[model samples]
Target chain A: MLSRNQIKYIQSLHQKKYRQQHGAFLVEGAKSVQEVFQSDFQIEMLVATEAFYKENTRLTDRQRTPVEIASVADLERIGTLESNNAALAVVRTKENLPLLAGPDEIALILDDIRDPGNLGTILRIADWYGVRKILCSETTADVYNPKVISASKGSFTRVNWWYGDVAQFLSQLGDGVAVYGAFLNGEDVHTLPFGTSGYLVMGNESNGIGPAVEPFVIKRVTIPSYGGAESLNVGIATAVLLDNWRRTGNLT
Target chain B: MLSRNQIKYIQSLHQKKYRQQHGAFLVEGAKSVQEVFQSDFQIEMLVATEAFYKENTRLTDRQRTPVEIASVADLERIGTLESNNAALAVVRTKENLPLLAGPDEIALILDDIRDPGNLGTILRIADWYGVRKILCSETTADVYNPKVISASKGSFTRVNWWYGDVAQFLSQLGDGVAVYGAFLNGEDVHTLPFGTSGYLVMGNESNGIGPAVEPFVIKRVTIPSYGGAESLNVGIATAVLLDNWRRTGNLT
Candidate 1:
């Protein structure tokens, strides 16, 4: 049985302030909790239903993390997902170290993306396309948000993210590294001469790339629209752009 | 001011049974309500704040749509959106008649896409890529669901959809029209020889193309994964596939 204090503490982690103060975040639902064990993040504890605990005892023991068997109701009460019958985990937040493009690697830059679901979907998309590092603008939705984690479908474990000033990061990029930004009026992504390695930046949902970051973009690319859609969703735009990037043999 | 009976009537349309019985659905939020006026849909009634009504008097007058001046609170209570400060409209749902591809026109087939948001997002993506007609399986989420309408961000105004047995529809497809189905193990979408005009079939969110619909696929396509991520969201996959289709000069 979870003590009231324990349940309150877990619930507190749902907000940014408590999460930052405790240096921990939540991984909820069956798939995400299972995958978090495969990640390098430090696990603080796990709360799971008896059925889930019995099924995953070996995985739980292998991680050497404390596990508390609880009812599905308990799990739902402490987590963000509408229906979580499996488990929830409290994981230590990783240090926000700097990440750069390795040779022949494409790094993603997210500029002021405010939606947690969009952020999570992008993480999954980036992971599918082999983008290991994501540079997020500080204004972007918190990577640790449960909504983002839930939407990521456990991809948060595989992708590394760093939050900072994206404009500064772009300005300091090494010579010969190109920067591709998605824009309404830009070079058609299908025909653009993508470099061997660079950064592809996506902008906010309502606005394109902010002025602070626009100047540093070496080339602007567009997934040419053929119909009446005013804009594509940011996550959808990211997948299409990354797909074209990999399709052009830019992926290593 | 909305009558108590009228407010209760709008709230009833939130459910599938009521929506079908009433033969009407809601279009909420500033953008969607504004765009619905441009669509061919019959406007039953529009509820708007006094400010919105004053600013859009010409537009409200153009369609001869009945208008009810309401507060934001009334709109929030009557609509599904958490925050709809501007307007909401009661739109007549279209007939689910048959829709087939035109010459050199691409059609979309959705097999059991269950998520309302995913269905709605797919509509927006299809609009962006110029895919006009969408054929949905009977099990797919209703296109008129408010969540779908809200997530579609006004694209429902442009795209046409038909609901029926997709398997039967595909089987009865005219000769020589190719049907491309997305699969994890299939021809790489990047290099697939897309036909001039055909159907791109997207499967359910979790199960992928249903067994009933799978046999109708003339060719299977995949957005090749380069990383450890297992799958892409259905909407993301749709965008990538359509992007490749358009990139290959198949969009006429």
Candidate 2:
């Protein structure tokens, strides 16, 4: 059972301002909440249906986190997801760790990916491709948004993400670190020689790479389109590029 | 100006039963509405702000469709999209054209892709990759769903989609036409040789290729995952497989 104030507090985390103010955000749905529960992220509150609570008795018993048994109506009232009848959790947002791209690792640099779903899907893609870190422009969608967390399908627990000025971050990279920027008229990615470690910069959904980060791109690569569609979705484009990198790059 | 009856009617089309009864589905937002306006699909009604109406003078003048000047509030009230301030069109869903897999063309076969957004994104990917036709399971998300139309980003206009039994359709395909189905433990796609034209089967989001359609697949291919992530989204997997086909297949 949730009190009025508890429900209000959970609802407030839906907004970015409130999430930042409270230093927490929502991880909604059964799959995401279950994944976060097993992850290292600290949980503040776990609101779940009787079924979910009963299914995970061991974790619920071990954790000192406050657990609230919620009805489907209560979850719909406080949670962000439309079909969240299972569970919702309030998780403490971790501080962005000071991390740098390693010499032999691939990282994704997102330049103003605005859609929360796209951002989340990209994180899942990164996790699938073994790309550890994602550097995002400050303009990118909030990682802690409920939509992002839900769309990520639990991969959010593995991928480390940080947001900063894309240009400044790219400039600070080690000398000779190849920066592959996705472009409309670049070298064919199928044939391009990709280094083992590099930052693959993907741009805004509508606009390609912005002018600010374009100069830092040492190599430009493009996925050759065979059809008449103007562009691929940014998330789809990222997965294709990452697949090519794994296939042809030194990392393989 | 939109009448209260017209508003209620438009809102009703949001449901599958009403859309079938009315034989129309909404194409919302300026980009999608503009694309559908120019497509072969007949438009029953064009609901637009004065701004959109004034800008698209040629389309409005030529078409016999009823034009309703609607406030942003009316569009928001009736449309499925949260940010549909520009335009919405009531488009008559076209009859499924009888299509067959050509000897020199690739096609996508979706097996119960349940998410409207995934179905829409797959359509866009198909359009981009030049895959002209898609054969979907009868259980697949409705192509005429407003969410599918919105997520397709106007690519729905180009891709031809059909719904039917997966096994029956595959059994009827011409001999020597390869069928590439995405699987977890299939051949590594990087080294796999692909034919010019074939059916690429993508399965449901969670369950993957259904058991009913598994027997019809000639070749099983998978995007080799380098990370610890469990699986790629069905939509992302489709793009990667299409990318590989374009690169290695005889089509290119």
Candidate 3:
């Protein structure tokens, strides 16, 4: 049984402010909830169906995660997902600690990717390519947004992201590291000499990279087009560029 | 001004049934509306704000696309987008024509892509890579779906897709053409000897290539993963695989 106040608290985490205030965020759906349990992130609590609780007894026991048995209706009402069969978790949010582009590491820099679904998909892409650290601009969607978490499909557990002023971060690195930014007309990605490691910057959906971050880009890279799309989705572009990097870098 | 019945008729196009009944679908927002005017498809009518009408007079006149000036509220109400400021159109739906895999053209096969957004993104991805034709499984989301049209970001204008039983289509090709299917364990995409022209089949989001379509695939291709992510989003995977195909096929 879920208390009204408890439901209200969980529901509040839907918004960024409430999440910040509570120092927690939601990981909904059975897969995400299960991923949260296995992640390093602290599980504050779980509202789960009895079946889910019973099936994952060892995992719950291992984490010592406090769970309240709830109905599907309770889960659906309190969670952001339209239909959550199994569980919803309240997990602790990670600190916005600074991240660096390690030597021989292909890092990702997201420049104000506003859509949460796109952000989540990018996380999964980053995870697939083994791009360990991501530097997200302040205007980027909140990584903890439920939509982002749900769309990540458990990749959030493996890939780490740091949110901060990307321009300032890029300025800090200066000419010491190569920064490759995706542009409409630039070096053909097919032939670009991608080094062993660099920072790949993807910009906002409508606008390309912000002016502040533009100067830091050592080389503007573009995937040559054969057809008539005005632009590729940010997530798709990221995967294409990263795949090229991995292929050239022999990291694959 | 939009009549209540006119509004009702336009709103009905938001569903597959009404779209089929009327033999037309919707193209919404300024960009898509603009693209539709420039495309080869027949335009049934347009509902635009005074601003949109006066601005794109040439475009609306180019196709002799009949226009009825309306308020932004009318566009928002009749269309699927939450915020559509400029215009929307009731455009003629293309026939379910049989598309053949051309000798030197890269083609896409969608095996039950369900998400309208994913299907839309794939269309955009296909457009970016210059894939001219796509064969969608009947279970795939309707090409005329407003969400698909919206998410496609106007790429629908350039990409030609045929919807029907994909298994029958694949069965028709049987060993005469190279069919590459995305799989968990298969040939490495990086080193795979990809020909200039072939069919790349992307499977359902969750189930992967259906059993019916599996036997028809000549080669199972896989994108090697370096990180902990379980799988790539179908759109991202399609982009990655398409990029490699273009590169290897010398179609770049």
Clashing pairs in 2: none
lDDT, candidates in the order shown: 0.92, 0.89, 0.90
Evaluate model 3: give its TM-score. 0.97
Interface RMSD of each: 0.6, 0.8, 0.7
Candidate 3 off by > 4 Å: none
**TM-score for each of the candidates:** 0.97, 0.91, 0.97
Best by DockQ: 3
Model 1 reaches an interface RMSD of 0.6
Q: Which digits, one per residue and each the tens of the lDDT, describe model 3 over residues A62-129?
A: 87888799999989999999999999989999888888877888889999899999999999999999
lDDT of 1 at B161: 96
CAPRI rating of model 1: high
- Tens digits of per-residue lDDT, candidate 2, B122-159, equal 99999989999999999999999998998899999999
lDDT of 3 at B203: 98
The C-alpha stretches of model 2 lying farther than 4 A from their native spots are A1-8, A60-66, A250-252, B1-12, B63-68, B250-252
Write down the C-alpha DockQ for each prediction. 0.88, 0.78, 0.91
Worst 10 residues of 3 chain B by lDDT: B243-252
Candidate 2 lDDT tens digits, A173-209: 7778889999999999887878888799999998988
